[model samples]
Target: MRDGGETVTFDFAPMVDIVLLLLIFFFLTSSLGARQTALPLDLPRASSAVKESPALPIVSVDPAGKVYLNGEATPLTSLGARLRPLAQASGGVVGLRADENGQYGTVVEVMDVIRRAGGTRLALGTRLPAASGATP
Candidate 1:
């Protein structure tokens, strides 16, 4: 070695492999969030409602009393028939997200229908009211 110069060495193969492994790890570990319904329902606000970490399957009941499962409108009479198969397939809880302005009787009716359809587990979706003087 005559004049000493800095040796240039670059190997990105290991870095690339590490990155790919990390990506795969994240993809495999991340929880799949709950599926949403197609129909939009303005849920009632609550001062104490807590947000669930993972979203739940939402069945929307509009002000007009129309029922929607996973966003597709289903007739009240056929609600149980339609929901049973979905519940069986998902092995997950079914839930209702109804407009606050909507009638309570309608929500009860929907619950009754769901129960009759063999949906044993159900949840209600709501968001907590913003704290006073806090930015939303």
Candidate 2:
């Protein structure tokens, strides 16, 4: 009867746990985003083009017929060496991007090199046409 009452305090263990969980979640997801490093080029338009998986290696060809592998300027003759390992790592899947104005023969030669380099699956990159009546 002599003592009145005592003060209470909040526990911070739950708050710390929630913060840790959020930190881990962001760290994991950040690495899963698209990591393409290919050079920027005006890709050909295709009605059937679809979104490609991010795991594949990208090879880009500019209008002047210069080939780039994963954003690095590479000679067409040496592409085989770089592509072989990439194809093996990605289960033979490789992404190809060629500028619309690029020479047709160059594109064909690149494809042939990719095939010889152990790439069994090929994905050509193209932009999808805008919907009709859409403003720029």
Candidate 3:
């Protein structure tokens, strides 16, 4: 046999490693974003808003009328009692996060509760419009 031929091969290990790294990076980042918000909520859009401070007390209302105090599920009847201390500690300013599509009655009730809990000022949670690429 008198035949001379050369073959070239491409290694895919490096390419696969890069793809895996990218996948892991995206997965980690996406999960991290979810950590900022206690629960999933479709917040109302606002044209002007500022970054929320972590020091403020946070109250959230879900679409099903469930209430949350800084991520923990709280009963409507006892929310005021539980939130009172936080409100006072935060200087009577509380951050309220209510889902845009949630029950209007629940949101109103939550607001009333916040007021009764000694939260004199409310920092309503709203998302910046899609047109404006900003974080708040």
lDDT of each: 0.73, 0.87, 0.88
Order of quality (TM-score): 2, 3, 1
Worst 10-residue lDDT window for candidate 1 reads 31-40
lDDT of 2 by residue, 18-110 (tens): 999999999999987657774658887777668888888888899899998877899999999988998999999999999988888999999
Per-residue CA lDDT of model 1 for 1-136, tens digit only, reads 3367767788999999999999988877774545563455666666667665344445788888888887788898888888877666545567778887787898899998877766678777775676783534
Better of 1 and 2 by lDDT: 2
lDDT for each residue of candidate 3 in 1-136, tens digit (9 for 90 to 100): 2255656678999999999999999999877652344599888888777778877889999889899998889999999999999899989999999899999999899999999999999999998666657644
TM-score of each: 0.64, 0.76, 0.68
Error of 2 at 125 (Å): 0.6
Where in model 1 is the C-alpha error above 4 Å?
A: 1-11, 21-33, 37-40, 53-55, 88-92, 133-136
lDDT order of candidates, top first = 3, 2, 1
TM-score of candidate 1 on Cα atoms, chains taken together: 0.64
